[model samples]
Target: MYSPEFRREAVAALKTSTLAEVAANTGASPSSLRRWVGRSDLADRPRSGRPPIQDTADQVVEALVATAGARISGKDYSTRALAEATGLSQSIVSRSVRGLTVPLTDVGGGRELSLVAAGFPLLILGARTEDAGGEDGGGGPAVPPRRIQRRIAGIAAALRSAGVGRWAQRFDSEHRQVPTDNLLELIAAGGSDRFLVFDPLGEVPVEVVAESDSRVEVHRDFAEFLEALKDLLAGCQDIPGSLLDLLSARVRNGLEGVLWRDSVGVDASRSSMSSDSMEISSWLPKETRSITEHLAIALREEIIDSAYEPGDRINPRLLSRRMRVPRASVDAALRRMVDDKLLDGSRGGARIPLITTGDVLDLYAARMAIGEVVLRSLSLRPQRYLVPVQLALRQVEASAPTRSGIDVEDADLHYQQELARASGLRESARVFEAVTLRLRLFISVLQLDYSPASDRIVSDDRAMFAALSRGDAKTAIEVWRGKVDNAVRHMAGLLGRRRFDQELWTQLTRSLA
Candidate 1:
């Protein structure tokens, strides 16, 4: 069904264009368009039937049975195969199978679906039942235990191809009734690894099956079921030994994409598995940033939050132990901060630097010089970067109302950095990044409260963004230079109040002797 807004748009177009034109453009049939025209309301009329069942436990059981039946009959099972066998819609079958399988790239660089080991018990039971019902109740031809073992071996091979390990460890630890020595010996003899090691004679407990049934009953749709499964696996501790319970945990973590490669051994430029991995990567709670980078960011935050005072010495060894990171990584991060002028490392160890008025002026002067070049370059093609520049300015405006001075300072720094990046000059952007880092340290050390000046700060940023949007390089540079001068004046006043030495300040400010 079309949304109300979509119907409104179609009806609105009818006043200016013919019904055929509107229908062709909107992809709605002419008959539907006729029914929608001249209506007082554009909203859809309510339907009067019960909705179709998109997913249910019964549907899942049916699909599992079909898959098992097909496997025993020497036929490949797919969504279409299951639909034909069970006389259900393909959509229903697909939804049921989604929780039961994982897609992995085969050696030939094509995606192939493999049933997870968690579902193996259900398949075995289904196959046994199908055999028993066949051709006059003599249990027809029994499925060979060797064939079942081979299937288990295949599932293990599929998982291994995708770089997954320890998949069958839970099965072995929780479900095995045999002694550890015997299991180890079996493994050493190359008898099907942990994946195939299950007690075929063991029966699933009634309570366990009932629990799964009750849980599935609460999930009204496939999405709810999927979300519940994710939450279950995410917080799962003391998972049960039953195969159904194991299925819930394994289905969430066992799915891994196989890296695709060409016949000549070079990695493929793009593949189905790569695309799937990209989609799934966002949901996985894993850090992509390196430890050193994370440490640097954390240290910067600590400094801005006043965790360290001026002239306070930083010990990397103690920091590594406190943060629980490698000493070398902490040292690397400290060195990086020192190079950025955020920490002073001159006297045998890193310490927070005491900011003087002269130091503040020098920092602002460096920024002004870099800003002039960056702003001028960006003006050459201002329209190409207007969106991101405006976004950065908006962030400053958003942080202006917050009581946290650090938030406003960080946002302002980000705005400056965005302008530098928008210039398209890579080398200048890198240099400007270092200058901004020093500026961040300058503000933090002086404990500048940006809340009072946030309005003016945001106003100045909006003016700068507007000037850049109009390709007015001169106005943009002047605005940036004025901001630098204002900052220098504030710092000089602050230092004067702190009783800084006038003689040393004058000597340091002398450009030439």
Candidate 2:
């Protein structure tokens, strides 16, 4: 039988892979994998008394606390406002608030809810008394057992009033079961704006706030956390420039502690652990991508940056030594990239594929056909589907004037990928991504040796954006067709300069026509 930890690792792998893939990697049957996922709760056990609390109830209580904090800070406390702040539905918030037994008075005949004066002290005390518990006696700081009990009572009362009494009881009891470091990593990777960890007393001893550039500010004190919350609320309503300025100020304040040691430092620290042990331990955190996946991405970047030329063989042993990962992992990554057509695996090993003029034309033709379908679907969808597309276009525009051709190419590729994703065509998006992988090799070669011109890329993309925005699918397709034809001609010219066969090039061009 697999251990709980083994099952947990398998479930984690399922997040970024298919069930069959996980089963093949783990040597487990598909049925067993499904069962493990179904029963993957870390705290799986039978409760003796009352029914178990649902995750939705937990979400509601957390939202209520955030709402309460905002209300006390003089922000808008209406259901709609609370929903926006907590990323919950307005109907859920309204239903939860109505169910709560807390003494709340209705403003505008129940259109808005306000906690009674006595309730405020309980929430404030609950927030303040929530200590990290290990601080006393060189651990950090200590609170009296009686004070802890009082804090628990107050928070439990609030939760009980909200019909989550069972959850309140489980709060203190289950705190130790949580893997703190793993939870922090997961929160850092999640999309939530705010996350709070209560320490039995309903006091938030750990709070994580998402910041720009994929960073998170972790606040450890209730007062300090409340101040950060105010900033978050203010930043949300402010203009983009002002919001970035405020974020920069906050980042500067915490820069010292935020800097982490590089992989070399981590490697140095892992000397005591066996390599097998380290590999197993790394798989425990769901937020941490698999080693093979990381290696694949790193190798992909190397290829896209033209570190390897066409027909150059990839040495897994040398890469393993250079990257400080197991050779097996490097081999697996090479195999994955080969499967994606980013590398050719013939001649008994993986190597960069030599590009042919016909190959370029074929890739562009496939991309054009897929792009037409995606663009048409996108035009038919609601306007909100274009948000990511717009952001990607902005990146392309911003990088156009930069001296780095690599930057411009990267942005343009991302814009196309985003366009595919926003189209809501999953299969088309997947195929488009595979086609783009081969296209990246050509683009890299052009950027490195040929210095292919890209003057029209930004203008063409902008025009397509405008067409898609106006729901003009015909114009968008025409613009895309023009862009593809331009790319084919440019690549053909580059190949001609390199002395490819004239007869083959002519035949390929005819097929395109």
Candidate 3:
């Protein structure tokens, strides 16, 4: 079925254009077009049906048969005994019992079980969750209750932010299970406006499946499942949330320009501004700045965002054409950034700065010292500085660190840059931004030699944000120091160097102080 927006667009088009034209524009069949026009509304609604229930008996029977087939020390279950254990009628249990893929002997009146004396694929669901609070640290299921609760809370927050909080409350997350064939049957029967979560029991490498409108989306884990849910709710008219709503206002507001630029790549020069690109550009902050200032800000954002990786050449000619500006303006911006130490122009051209083991140690020492001073300053004037830090935190929270190469790193640096800009110590903040840029570029270069844990970077930022929000300067600085120390340690190992020059490190630390 066509979405409400598509139907409305078609109706509006029909007022000025022919039905055939509308059909062509919408990719809707002529019959579908007529029906859409005939309908007063195209909103998705739940189909009339009874609430779906699982075939507990069938599943219970399957479990019993599998268990009995194992023949653990010659123990077995009769049909009547199985019915009692499973709370099903004996007749139902009898009918539910089926031949297993693995052969077992029916020894006790064709009821006793024996394992097949043949080689066969035996599926084992041996996956384990985090140990629970028991003597043996035994958990009933692989998915721990605390983990499930956290996921549910996260979903609630996403739904609430998406303006579907009322609908979200109706879901009993504690009752969440993997959708089985029986559950899918009922859901398909019930039709639109149905949402379900299912996790199969004892399946190693468990998958979460979401089915709707004869379509199934399978996710490998809870995180991916949440991402799928976000997509679903964002697209559903019934949810009252757009894709933009899934992201923070700051991200949604700024992302279009960034995304468009990324998509166009080197060929941005050849293409005219698309309608979508124009719309995105229009949403950008309309500052009355010169082309040079704009170019510098854009480049700085890309650098801070890690869009420009270490060793990536900043081709002035390509940039000038891509941004539709003068070469001199681009050149001027490059020179300004180079002067600010945000980019390196040492070899032949402006490029992302590279670093060595010595650079890493000195940068971390400076960053740690700068962070201490900045946190102290923020503690003195939390009211003045905390708001922007919180605002930047939202921007980072809205971004997905795991989905992209640059997004997580970019978001991490972007917020730190914001915090630095908000710091009362202007000189310290300036030095922090330069040092951060240098460190991130160095890490990017290090990635060419060894893989680094990007998630650690994101986690540190979150920890720092949490501390900063509480006006806990000491803890925030400690977290910040830990982040720097981690990067330095990793980079030092990659360089086969144990330590940086002690004299140079002392000088950099003194500068931050």
**Candidate 1 stretches greater than 4 Å from native:** 1-296, 304-307, 317-324, 339-341, 497-513
lDDT of 2: 0.51
Q: Give the TM-score (vs. native) of candidate 3.
A: 0.39
* Candidate models: Cα lDDT each: 0.50, 0.51, 0.47
Residue 46 lDDT (model 3): 75
Q: Give me the displacement of residue 314 in model 3, in angstroms.
A: 4.4
Task: Name the 10 consecutive residues with the lowest summed lDDT in model 2.
Answer: 107-116
TM-score of each candidate?
A: 0.40, 0.41, 0.39
- Per-model root-mean-square deviation over C-alphas: 26.2, 29.2, 27.7
Deviation of model 2 at 140, angstroms: 53
lDDT of 2 by residue, 437-488 (tens): 6676676544332214445788889999999999999999889888877777
Candidate 1, TM-score vs. the true structure? Answer: 0.40
What are the clashing pairs of model 3?
A: 177-198, 177-199, 178-198, 178-199, 179-198
